[model samples]
Target: MDKNKFIKDNFGISDKTLKLVSEAEESIKEQFKHIENICEINQLRVMKAFADNRVSDSHFVATTGYGYDDLGRDTLDRVYADIMGAEDALVRHNFISGTHTISTALFAVLRPNDILVSITGKPYDTLEEVIGIQGEAGNGSLKDFGVKYVQIDLKHDGTPDLEQIKFTLTHMNVKAITIQRSKGYGWRPTYSAKDIGALIEFVKEISPETICIVDNCYGEFVETEEPTAYGADLIAGSLIKNPGGGLAPTGGYIAGKQKYVELCAYRLTSVGIGKEAGASLGFNRQMYQGLFMAPHVVSQALKAAVLCSAVFEKLGFEVDPKPNEIRHDIIQSIKFGDPDKVTAFCQGIQKGAPVDSFVTPEPWDMPGYSSQVIMAAGAFVQGASIELSADAPIKPPYIAYMQGGLTYESAKLGIMVAADKMLRKE
Candidate 1:
């Protein structure tokens, strides 16, 4: 049977949808090639990190109990540190999620009187409770612990407000500041590595004592240089995102200067038992393999994001960082005005998934979010955004956030599936 017929018979993709996918791909060949170039540079960096750390069968052995003297765990930390251009690193499945890792980094460095300012305005929705900006106090939030929080909104053009940042840091006794490298739930464009580096320099020039932290969840390997290369004190993210390469079942990492990473490690375990306490359990190989594959996987995601923008923009919907733009993260947002359209698009994405394709995703009040979120992810690992997923908050200016594609081919089909359902009414 023809490939188009196969898709139509097996998945119900319309001929129009298949034609749209082809046109979108044809228009973005240059962008796809550009992603490949980035992948090549990043691949070299990962391979060198592994080889330099002497990764071998010995480093793949899993330990149990206290995990003391776990060669694999320790060596992998070194590998991650090298890749991040940081002095030290803490990588472990104990982190649970990206937000957890970020919270740990904040708690590790902040004290009762220390003021923590977010230069990127507000952070992702999940951080609202953690920062004590939302939810009840006395739950060990930053505010509950007496840590002051300040925010500087981005400019109307979506760039960082450097002038305001300088003014804020000039006189304030700021102890620490954070930069969210990814767009998160915002419609703003993601900051590139060079952009982040300049921000770090500006902040350091004004407030030399302030510790700089970056939430690097979806931005890893998107560029050759990470925030650490620009002198970030600490960078944290979830293993289920970019760095996991869609293979790590569960984990997170914080890589940066030795002092901060050591502090975070202590927080992850205990004061006396830093990185030495957590056992690799049975996940050593998967984590290592995931890092090895991350560069290529990230490229697949970038390509998908570009194609998604191309198709959505051509259809007269609003898209952030249009298809021709250089992306700093993997997420692609499409503004859908109607709630029903949001549901149909999400369900279409779910249908293209390899797992749970028969199931329809629906909106629910998921924890840690301000709004009811409808998430569609048919992934091998639950909630792994690296494997073709779309999620949206069912509200005004309802925009769907689509990301992750372990393979470009899979993501292309998923986009087509979504387009078919989304345009059915018209």
Candidate 2:
């Protein structure tokens, strides 16, 4: 069957939703132009130099540290620092996952009894076990080290509660404050780098001495500026999510002041050794290329999100495409209000996956989450692949959270397919 007819038969999408999709695509194109301009003006030279050097080949030699002088690694460390606009940056292909990076950073900064306040409620589901909420099913994390955990409430509007944040800082013995920029478990309200900066300012004013850390995964390259621009003491992130650009096989990054980076590096590699001596098996040259193309690629994803939000809203589903003006990035969530429709929508998107395809939606126990019945159809071998992923929380009101597309074409196709499926069900 033809694509349109197939869609009409399986899912019903209205003409109004289609029109909104077209308009959103146009807006996305305009945003892409702006992104291109920014890259050309600011990062093109550095990117070009990296491309000319073919830095990926030197990965083994550069990271070997077997017989290399410490001076060379130290110099490269300074260079990375300059790239991140910080006193120091440590770029290693060693951090295996986002959790690893966060764990290392926490270990570096927090003492055995130091207090750690999560300014953004509970963290992603994967962290629940690590943070002491769940039992010792997984690797023992920060909670295992005897650190105190605190959570501050967010305001009704979804931003952090400034007054409560101040109360926590003043009353609690908070040694470190962590702000997760992206939403937990693949659901994020479009937030930009500048928004992160504002949050940093708020924290600094209340407790200047307390260490401020930001989980910058899924947020890199989405905005022109970065969290470090606003004074984040340490920013930890996954390369595969945004900066990796679908190029790196797997890895994470930590950027911040030299002292903190050194401390984290020690924690990542060991108390005495650093990542400089670790195996380079984790870093991929494709990741470097992906990072170069990320700004434009992410712009396309954002466009898709905006378009999808408009389409879902027109179709009678409550939608929040741009929750806040400060949030200016990708990620669109649509409330299906029906479990079956949410499943069908996910199926439709999976059919359009670039890498692989499958449909097995069911309820299973996910660590760190009280909610049950989570479903995901992702293209990547690991769940981090955002090429096309849409899942909904199984609660009273079900909403499918969707984001990530390699290109505007695929993202638009996925949205159209899912819309068609929903329409057919109706």
Candidate 3:
């Protein structure tokens, strides 16, 4: 069967939107051409890292106690470090989530008297709790630990507020500065690697001693360059989000300068038993294979994000970083303006999922977030954003966050289903 027919039969896509999807076919192909260049550059980098680390079939075997001399784990860390152009890296299966890895890094380098500044406005929701910006400060947050936190909001045009950054850097005894490359739940545009590089240069010129860390969850492999290549002191991301290729069960990674990475490792394990102590527990094969496939998987997701933006824009809804704009992350946001539309859109997405298709999603008070959120994630692996998923918060303007498509086809079909349902209501 043809692509359009298959979509119509399977997802019940409307005739009007089917034409829109068909019209978008050529444009999606054209956009993917640019993505091919990005994938090509990143593929070469991944291959070089693997080759330099001498990755072999034997490296896939797991180790048990203490994991000393675990070649697979060591090589994965080395390859990650090399690909990011970092001095060293600490990649392990022990770090629970992206927030855990980021928290470890913060606690490692920051002291009670030293200040931590975020120049990219407030960070993601979970980071607010971790940084002590919300919730109880008694949960051993940075604020409770006596580490001062300051944030600089972006300008009206959505660029970083540089004047405030300079003022903060010149006066405060700032220990580290954080740049969130992804847009998170905000409506702001995602920062490209080149843009992040400029920010890194600006910070260095003001205070060369300050550590610059990037929360690099959904931004990996979307561009040929990464924040680490542009002189970020440290970068952190979750394996389940991007680097896992939708295969890693659970984990996160932090890669950067040898001293900083070592500090994070020390915090992850112990001072004397840093990276050498974590057991691979039979996940070496998936982690290694996942890294090898990450570039291709990330490209698929990027194409889907562009497609989502285009489709939503055509439907008279607001979309951030329109389809034709330069993209640095896979997330695409669309404003629906009504709670009923939000529910219908999410249910439509869930209906197209490969798993849990019979279930319905509803808004509820989810932890780590201020608002009630409804999430539709029917992934082969639980909570894997690298697969097709959509989420939204129950608040004013009612925007839905869509991200991750393991394959471009899955993402395309899912969006068509949601758009069909949403447009039918009109």
List lDDT for all candidates, in order: 0.91, 0.66, 0.88
Best by lDDT: 1
The 10 consecutive residues of candidate 2 with the worst lDDT sum are 59-68
Clashing pairs in 1: none
| Full-model lDDT, candidate 2 | 0.66
Q: Per-prediction TM-score, please?
A: 0.98, 0.84, 0.97
Using alpha carbons, what is the TM-score of model 3? 0.97
Count residue pairs with overlapping backbones in model 3. Answer: 0
lDDT of 2 at 288: 55
Instruction: Tell me, by TM-score, which candidate is best.
Output: 1
Model 1 lDDT tens row, 390-419: 999888889899999999988888888889
Error of 1 at 412 (Å): 1.5
**Pairwise TM-score winner, candidates 1 and 2:** 1
Q: What is the alpha-carbon RMSD of candidate 1 to the true structure? A: 1.0
